[model samples]
Target: MPRQACKKGSHACDGVVRRNAEPIAYAHGFDWRPAYNCKQWFAEHSEQMTSDRGGMMKRYARPLRLLAITALSVFLGETLVMLLLPFLEPLPQHVKVLLDASLVTALVLPMLYYFLFRPMALYIGERDRTQKSLSKLSSAVEQTADAVVITGMDGVIEYVNPAFESYTGYTQVEALGQTPRILKSGKHNSQFYEALWKTILAGGVFRGELINKKKNGELFHAEHTITPLKDDSGSITHFVSVWKDITERRRAEEALQTFSQRVMDAQEAERRHIARELHDEMGQALTALSISLQTAEETAESPAAAEQLHQCLGFVERLLQQVRSLSLDLRPSMLDDLGLASALRWYVDSQGQRAGFIPQMELDSLKTRLPPELETAFFRIAQEAVTNVVRHAHARQVRVQLHRREQEMEMVISDDGCGFDAQGLQTRNARETSAGLLGMRERVLLLGGQIAIDSAPGRGTEIRVRVPVE
Candidate 1:
């Protein structure tokens, strides 16, 4: 019969036990005798050695095997050659011995290199390099600012880095093995997700802006890219997603847009004030001068003097006309007194004079006036759209339509001219675009409305704008 041995004390750790004067309750499995070793040094540290021996063995196992195989091959080759040397033609014993040794060396060296040493060297070297790179990658993922998510092929969350936990209001314990759909914000439609899944399943990377919710249900915007991970068989194994929160950046951009709109509005108001000054003060003065010159011409006794007074009065009339034209250019009085519709009609007429093509006009339900700020925004947008048509659209005809409803107002202007690219307008620097497309967009957007432009090169251009009446 075989017997098991143990110490009558606690198993302080693996491969280690402590002894005391009295037997303890823990040492019950196989102890029937007194244990022998009781060195304090070994008792304190033997557990660490036992754990490390397994790891070190695995590390050196392949190289040790290679060394053993090479040694055996050399021994077998030398022994076979030495036996064959005895049968060969007679020679001096020392020389024959040397010859056999040299032959064995020559045969065994290449065999060792080709069969074991070179292959092990190449494989171990590559594995070590790969492991180091993987270690670096793991560290970077853990410390980076961008949120990183690793999920199973079926979209089950597997791992999330620190940044992910910080922004998502989730801890590692709460997120594992859950579906990523738990974070859906519902802002993106089903089609959006369908497209995203389709791209990833097809082995393509998906990159886009997303609106995602956190654990506490706060929605935020993120710019993210999701890439598929594949196994050696080229089948999708998992997904890696990296994202950054862009909520603050987007808010700042929106604030900047608002500030720009305010500046534009103030500038327009100042122009209106200047226009009123020109019309009321300068026009009246010029009219009075013309009247005085006419009276002088009537009282003149000499013909030459009367002729000169007549010429002077004509100059005064021209000057008055110039001042009136300039006043209207700055701001039309009809816009203030009547409303948006009246002002638009007058503008169409005035532009017709300059461009030699009066746009075909249509107006509907224009009886009630809108709020002052809304009216101003609508007018400015229409003005810019029409001006672009006259300056850039070389077409001989234009169409302008304004519709007023209970809840909203919409304007559509179309021209049959050489149209420019809408994308080109968007890409150009804000100040460099000649059409004022960006300014027009800002105006309508500030009013919580949408503006759309349909244009194509060598074709025609159409601009549409809608704003809420309130």
Candidate 2:
């Protein structure tokens, strides 16, 4: 063993019995080395605790003073008994001795209660309450559905509750003294862990989703929260990580999103079919009818008949125009032929003219066309928003902007109109504005996009949308 020359009473070697590679101390002459840095830490804390006890003793000096008074009480009782003994001279000698002892005990009992018994009783009561509270906390942690883990400042697992064992498939014996990396699933990168450690080490609570592996090699999603535990000196001593399994909920959400996308695709296909039928079949028939009526008017025998035929031809033309407009509204052919930009321009121009609102358009050229589904979805969403503006907004001016960025397409539509409660309209479960806004949300969701509608009562409305082109 290596040794350092030092005196037994010196500060450097006061408690150390031997200085080997691992310093060893003596416990009742038996050598032992404290674990890790615990020797120095325990020395400091023990000194602090001793000082605290000394302070407590000083604070209650009255109890020591009361001890002297109790002794004096015994003396006073004996002296008084001696004084009264002359009056009871006829009593037996043994009886007199017993009387004196009784008197001394009676005098000292109250002082003993104040100096000793009362404090003991209070301490016992406080200890009981603390034990009960700790028991309740332990029970709650053991019984809760969420997994709870407590780790030392060095990130070594110190404690794990029943839920932790159940969720992670790691028994307490297997997990103890192991680091949290045992649960790593490799789904998260280095930066993810770095951020987590940074937040927790700074005494900030960290909350986020994580993927962790169980002992059985199964991965699960968890909503995790890590909180730092501090001691009286405000130094972080441990980290408590609580995790709730959310794998099933995540899977269900993914399934629902897939179903919604399929539904949107079906709806779009149906709309396209209907629009084509109306444009090709009804439109041709209406045109033929208008031409026939015009020919009849030109070759009519009577002037009144020709005038009647001209009126019918005008009515047919008007009907034909409405049919064509309805077909375009359903799904424009220009959207498929010339792409999103041309279709949006035509629709906005016509809507602006009909609704008596000045439309301001800033559209990107989009040299390459977007997917057919994306174009249709965006066009329909724009259509619905503009329709709402015309019917309810009563706006004087509408502005539309479309841009194709590196990874996404962005669109913004704003109107200086009499706006409604955008928030209330969105959250209201009833059919109040559900059909239109819900449709828009579904379309955006199908395209893996996001949409935000900003409006307040008496304030103008703005709809901003972004969708990934990839």
Candidate 3:
């Protein structure tokens, strides 16, 4: 064999390689058949011509791997152990000899891989897994329906999801590291935020509705919760806030309230118009007949005709009184003109006459007038409760009170009659109650008020209401 391939810088030699060439030979995935390399002049040399190759091997390892992969592209370019597969117990003589002759079996490299390379490889695999897990977590937060916000213990923004961006019209880049004060709508006072911070910082969850301002300076309602996140040792590390936009929900509630009020108002207006028509048209006709009957009676041909006209005249008077009472029942003109106090007093007196006694009344210092809608709600609620007491209470005595105190107005109706289990009313269907108690509750709630009916078997009923006053 010629020596040029292994020589230093000759025409036929790229460079002198005074190193063991077995690993390189294996890396190419095929024999190179180099002249005077490996076993020939390199092995026969008695002089020391070799140098250290560990650094070089490590440096060129990746490129050599790629080249090996390309060179053995035909089949899986794996180690002979892989090719040997399941034939591990008793190998063929030639294959066994080839294995024994390989550098892995003959040299110290395989032992070194166990001692040195395995830890590094395991570390890289674990790192790759962690990266993938983090990526998936980030994606899930971005795609989740609720807006997510992660803040440090000091309330500095650390992360926010895409939904939050859409909700507040603020991008992630704009939100990071900024305090949440940017989104404040000023609807909530400092005390509100202080309470929220105290709750969450104590490792408790804080939940409530708040008005939040968007990037465009428009305000919206957000229902949100903030929960403290703890480390393994139980120290609080961060706070995770989740937000749901509730502006549409609030709007829907207001719309329903407006619609309900309008429906009630329209019914009252229609009744009033019908009542006026009945009184004007029917009363005039009846009066004309009465006058004609008087004249006919004075000039009657027989006493039978005059007596019949007298009976008819009495019936007409009764009919007129009935129509007027019916008109008042539909909607009292006093309620519109004199406000809630007069209307309520009239209602209590009317109920008293039927109940056989007047209720113990207390109306001192009551606000004489309220907003029209609020007044209507209060009147209707009172009317319903009064009706319930009269029909169901079966008591001889009752009490009615209305007064204003501080920022609130309150009303209470109590009866001394045979009471019922008010709790059972909740279980009963609305239609079962002859009184419109459920409608009263709805009206009270729409006005941002509370109504409570308390009663027990053999104990008299009490309906108490409290509403904020402007």
Candidate 4:
């Protein structure tokens, strides 16, 4: 038999032959080449050919194995047909039989390989690639610094990554099958949770800061982003929550806020002291001078001069009253002695008399005194609110209500006046004119309170303030 030629020149032939030289064995009859030379050539090139063939087999093993099995099955079926040919009386001759078998192998085998075996192999490879990609994604999420938690549709935790365990002190085993409520610190009430669930179930993302309890019962703060994951049918299947531990950030922010509040309080105290000096010291000296002028006029012989001194004394008394009012506005002694309710009523009545508006005061279930700080905060807010109404509201009637609810104090002030735009009143220019409202809000916030203003164009405004009583 004639052997195939190697495509490239052999290494042994490289120096002896020029480039593009043909193999020495080409066109040689079966017996023409010397047996010894043939054996030597075979020995030299066999290893290289064997190595190349082995690499090709390894690279195409899966598809080739499948093709071989399919081909063998077809060959066997054709052989069975040939064996049964003798039983048929009109069977074709050997030449026709050989041609038919050749045609079946050539046509049927390649079709089966292309349509069935190749597609199956490609699908298997693709599935493996998909699995590898999913594994990489899972590993990346697990190693992230942010806490990753996946919960079932029912809000029960199904999976939590290593970062979540590290930040929350809850191991995977402990957190599995647990609800997020396990981390609740109880700082917020049921209403808060209701709102959170409402927003999330409506297919909206929820973002907020929460105080959560860890596995060891230590509380920590976290900024959380929760998103609902949906299936192909657009139904929510799970919730993915990404959170970062923000305990230190929250602590630093709170420290800064406390420092700022302390500075404001100190400044207010100094202002109160100065106002007292002006009203008591300077005001008294003016009164004495006015009295002496009246005495001197009475001792004089002229009646006209005595009348003028009396008018001067009246003006002096009015000046003293104005100074006293300024001092009281700076720091009211009534807030410390009479409590928040009485102080608020006094402020409303005094502001009404000054601004010429009819003031309506209502107090419910606040007969007892409160903490000094609370009393002062409430009094200041009331003072600021009434002042704003008088200066800006342009109203004829004002109503102030103070009510003590369970664990909270609620105050509302409403006026029948031409109210300005609340949103527009938040800018720099509006703040200058509405400094009283801003001051009231700051004071309420310092006392752990919230204020809400309801107003629109051409409508009366209402302000509601709520503070924690405990």
TM-score of each: 0.64, 0.78, 0.62, 0.64
* Candidate 1 ranges beyond 4 A from true positions: 1-112, 181-206, 213-219, 230-234, 284-302, 333-342, 362-375, 388-395, 399-438, 444-470
The collision pairs in model 1 are none
User: Which candidate wins on TM-score?
Assistant: 2
Q: Each candidate: what lDDT?
A: 0.80, 0.85, 0.74, 0.77
Please identify which of the two predictions, 2 or 4, would achieve the higher lDDT against the true structure: 2
Q: What would you estimate as the lDDT of candidate 3?
A: 0.74
lDDT of 2 by residue, 58-85 (tens): 9879667877888799889989998999
Candidate 4 wrongly placed segments (more than 4 Å): 1-140, 153-157, 170-209, 215-217, 234-236, 264-268, 300-315, 424-434
Model 3 residue 401 distance off true place after TM-score fit, in angstroms = 1.7
Ten contiguous residues with the weakest lDDT in model 4: 26-35
Residue lDDT tens for model 3, 138-245: 888889989998887667788998999999999999999886778888787756776776677568998899898999999999998888898644767788899899
User: Which predicted model would earn the best lDDT?
Assistant: 2
Which prediction has more favorable lDDT, 1 or 4?
Answer: 1
- Which TM-score value belongs to model 3? 0.62
- Which residue window of length 10 is worst by lDDT in model 3? 23-32
Arrange candidates, best lDDT first.
Answer: 2, 1, 4, 3
